[model samples]
Target: MTASWPPAPLSVDEPVGAPTLLPARAYVRAEVLAWERRHLFAGTWSCVGRVDELPAQHGVTVGDVPVLLTRDGDRTAAFANTCRHRGHELLPDGGSADGRVVVCPYHAWVYTLDGALRAAPRFRDVPGFSAADHGLVPLPVEVWHGWVFVNATGDAAPFTVHLGELAGLVAPYAPEKLKLAARHDYRVRANWKVIVENYQECYHCPRIHPELCAVSPPNSGHNYDLPGAWVGGAMDLREGAETMSLDGRSRGAFLPGVDRRRVLYLALFPDLLLSLHPDYVMTHRLRPLAPDTTRVECSWYVAEGVLDASYAERFWDRTNRQDWAACESVQRGLASPHFRPGPFAPNEDAVQRWVTLIRRAYLGTPPWEGQ
Candidate 1:
């Protein structure tokens, strides 16, 4: 199903004073998650990993569909990870390097890095068998600013088009020139949407994130509603604050041309979250494991050869744990039969936009109409 871009405006009669959140079932129902897996995840551009992570070969799941990334010479290619013979998974999840050929563990079907069927054990004996007709199915993959994003349906619009003006907003950081500095993964007991909603708004910042609020006031920012699938804005840092580290000081050199007084936060719907600071960029890629569980991979990037990242890492680790704890609490409450849709605060405009876009993608209706 094609998503309706720039979701239609909400109904005027829809109550904003106590604007209802997406129904509780949306967070804990198995059928609802399956619908999202088929429509939302399958049809959008979801980031998988960094370009450097797949220098050889890597296997990953975009939503629920397993895919493989291989570097063929100077180019990277993506294909369905299932072998054609019997639908067995070709490579293990998270990737591995066993040379140029990908050999299926079940039947030993060998495929070249470019996804060509190289050989199959005793397959020629079958009548009218042709390896040429059974090469791995290709998926659409685009590498933008050193990150790799893949679309399972292979029919979505170009990645840049989906990104809209976000590309220009973050151009000053020169993301392509930044190198990976540290990576951390967390498995949170929360729905993927819960995590996203928590990140999009800072309503809970002052109460939950003391250090973050000290450096960047929770009430000192405005939200921007960008076209396409992104929503974000810049938040001003405290008077003497250089960055969002534990001590309000920058841990490394400023990213080429970034402004030191403000930091940018963006929520790229369905999967990616970005935190752009003067000295570094932090990315969070969320993968849904179940209706109530998600796997979040957080990575930090900075100018090449800068090795000391403890300051930034420690601060974010503490902040992320706080966010995750809040999300988990919300998830538990959502499962209760008494839990109903609640009002959104004025500070949660970005969260409203996120909910609108996701509702459009999943139910083909705006949140107000559904309510």
Candidate 2:
């Protein structure tokens, strides 16, 4: 089985008008954290958790920063998950059923669901400061189709509009039907960019994913449609194409509204990667544990009411294992002294665009601005 996709190869010329290779070690600097907060985390929306997980009963922390997301009346609100007085962290892991008020474990400072200070353990003894002055810091949060997103910075472009035209790119994926399937966490020994770069291009697919390439005839083309962080590429459900797994269904089966289309991948900026086939969708989140190391979490989603346990597991397990194997191996190669920055292929323009957008946000310069 061969792919009907177009070939996209990058230029290999050196010392010309092209991107220079960045040092492999620069990803771990403390300065990068500040840059991420300001450039990446500040202005952009971040995937916090699944919409079902945001109820009052459960509280999840993103890294060491604890945050509380709960529904209030008809709306959802977010707080820094920290207490105002004594600066204690609130909501260790889980919260009460009501989650109406957050009480600091250390001093019993209480805050309303919306982060307003409601009471104190013993405020009568304190002077000058009042309950009104103490409240949980609010973090900007947004929800789209059951997915929860939060912006740590107080100031950011509205979530809906910040996405710009890119939102339209994913409109066809029917995000509303996407259901949580399976989640896998990975600790990788490479920069976060290494993992993202790996996902952004199919240049390595033919060499690393023989099973996937066999199933999706277009896997070798590397011609992907870049709708922001999401990638859409055609797959041949054409006759006789072997599948990644025997239990899996075709792409039309997963997304009922679509036609013969079979392949799609979407990455929620900074850290989330999600893809869909006919039977199920597998999503992954890559968290930067260190400059040189990252923790990756992948989840599978399927159509509601459809349960074939083995169907979802077999396909994702095989594909994910192959993906990680390739990424980890690439991480090892990045340490090589001979690994130089090469030119971008027309097919890889999406990766370059993603990198350009991120670098512009971080360094205030585009890849070809100086060239």
Specify the poorest-scoring 10-residue window by lDDT in model 2: 1-10
Clashes in model 2: which pairs?
3-217, 10-345, 28-291, 181-300, 182-299, 182-300, 250-278, 251-278, 254-278
Q: Which ten residues in a row have the lowest lDDT in candidate 1?
A: 5-14
Across 1-371, the per-residue lDDT of candidate 2 in tens digits comes to 11121211222223658764344444445556444544454335667767765666345455445667767665788777777887776766545356676677898877777778888876767778687777777877877766777765555556654554446645666666776756667787777777777777766677766666656653343335432433334344534542335423443245665533455555557666766555556667776766667778777766777655455566667766777777777667766766666667665655675565555444443111221
Q: Can you write out model 1's per-residue Cα lDDT over 1-371, one digit (the tens) per residue?
A: 33453322222233455656787778888877776765567667888777866757788877668888888666888898899889898877886785889888999999998889999899879999999998999988988887888877676666766777788877888888988888999999999999999988888998999999889989887888656677778899999999999899986888776788888999775688989999999999988989999999999998887888778999999999999999999999999989968878888988888776666655454221221
C-alpha RMSD of each candidate structure in angstroms: 3.9, 7.5
lDDT of 2 at 313: 66
Q: Candidate 2: deviation at residue 121, Å?
A: 2.4
Count residue pairs with overlapping backbones in model 1: 0
Assess candidate 1 and give its TM-score to the true structure.
0.91
